[model samples]
Target: MKKLLIGTAALAMVAGAAFAESHSVVRLGTEGAYPPYNFINDAGEVDGFERVLGDELCARAEMTCEWVTNDWDSIIPNLVSGNYDAIIAAMSITPEREEVVAFTQNYTPPSPSAFVAMGDVDLSGSVIAAQTGTIQAAHVTGMDGATLLEYPTPDETVAAMRAGEADAVLSDKDYLLPVVEGSSGEIMFIGDDVPLGGGIGMAFRKSDPEMRAKFDAAIQSMKDDGTLNEMIAEYLGEDSPAF
Candidate 1:
């Protein structure tokens, strides 16, 4: 979802001096619930592609960094409230979000969104599930004759479909691929893959251009030396998109 201005003061801060000070320890906010992108590992630590990428960017930028978990619905607002210095969540760069924050250059190329269902059911006029506040949710909302069931987490979206409460669950193909493969013929991909959002990028409060620039340069460095693509393959599989 696009960042919502929490209040008049929060709106003013976003418009005024949001994150003006240099942070010695830059806090990266993310949705710890999103897998492949991010998740709390069995060890109860933040672990995934973003965790690895965030650490490398912090190292290349020569800054001490820490990870902070937030629910996806409020991730952007927490950054605006100074709860974190930046968002490294697998957030797509979109004009609606750009109005509230600035994005570093994309770290991953645009990825397609897709749907999963039990059989060859048509999606038109069917009830579809999507994580609340996600591009998938917004897309399903606008689909002709489609009914949307929104959940707070990605897992719930899939769960609803499994329980037969939803005809299908829509999300990033990268996130759904493993689930479909593991379903043992119970679930399968359906319908055409839908391109959604721009490429994924890190976000900073608009006032924190310096912090944004630091990571942007670091991301470009990774892209230049091929470390970024290697990491993407390591975590997101060989077929995943590179910079």
Candidate 2:
């Protein structure tokens, strides 16, 4: 749900012009692995919450846009390199990440982080699995006497727990809730929820304030009209917090 890696390279204005031109394609990068937030459908196309929300935002902003999938680990660097214009992946607005890429105002409210295990397990001194480059991983790293097993994807963290590689898996609760429910009692939550990050927002290269401002206005528009809250309930869950 959160990632931070330093990327240093100025985005050229030629590429910035793409953000300026009417009907020009703005590539929105995402992992396409995290679901409900984002995932590839059976049609092998990027589909899910961000896909719909992004399309609406682009339409409101009067820009043409397309989806681009990249590994979670490299999503930020690629954006800095102009591989994509922005990141609409379910990324949280953490100060660490803000050091590298400027974020549009958050679109989704902060969700809880949670721990799930094969059965009820004590979190103290337990080995926990978390996705690489996520806030959960960073949080687990500081837990006293708890070992953190890092995986490169959300699915891997769950797989690691199922394989007995970790006592539990730590991740965004929204992503883990479906897994826990579908596990048929095989996995259950083990601890109080942990809240991390400011909220979920789109990330853009630091050089593209114009692009950032454009999307921010569109997002603010949604928040004002209650469409953002409607989409949050539809995509995230009815209980998810509103703007």
Instruction: Give one digit per residue, the lDDT tens place, for model 1 in 1-243.
Output: 221222233344453345544556888998888889999998999999999999999999888888999987777777887888899888988877777889999999988888999998778889999988788888888899999998888899999998999999999998998899999999899989898887899999888898899999999999999999999899988998787
- Would you list the C-alpha lDDT of every candidate in the order shown? 0.85, 0.85
Q: Pick the candidate with the highest lDDT.
A: 2
Residue range with the least summed lDDT across 10 consecutive positions in model 1: 1-10
Error of 1 at 26 (Å): 0.3
How many angstroms is residue 202 displaced in model 1 relative to the true structure, after the best TM-score fit? 0.3
The local distance difference test score of model 2 is 0.85
Model 2 lDDT per residue over 1-243, tens place: 654442334222223323443436789999999988999999999998999999999999888888999998878777877888999999999887777778999998888889999986778889999988888988998899899998889999999899989999999988998998999999999889998888999998777888888899999999999999999989888977677
TM-score list, all predictions: 0.93, 0.93
| Candidate 1 TM-score versus the reference | 0.93
Question: How much is the lDDT of residue 227 in candidate 1?
Answer: 97
Off by over 4 Å in 2: 4-23
Tell me the deviation in Å of residue 110 in model 1: 0.2
Q: Give the TM-score of candidate 2.
A: 0.93
Position 164, candidate 2: lDDT: 89
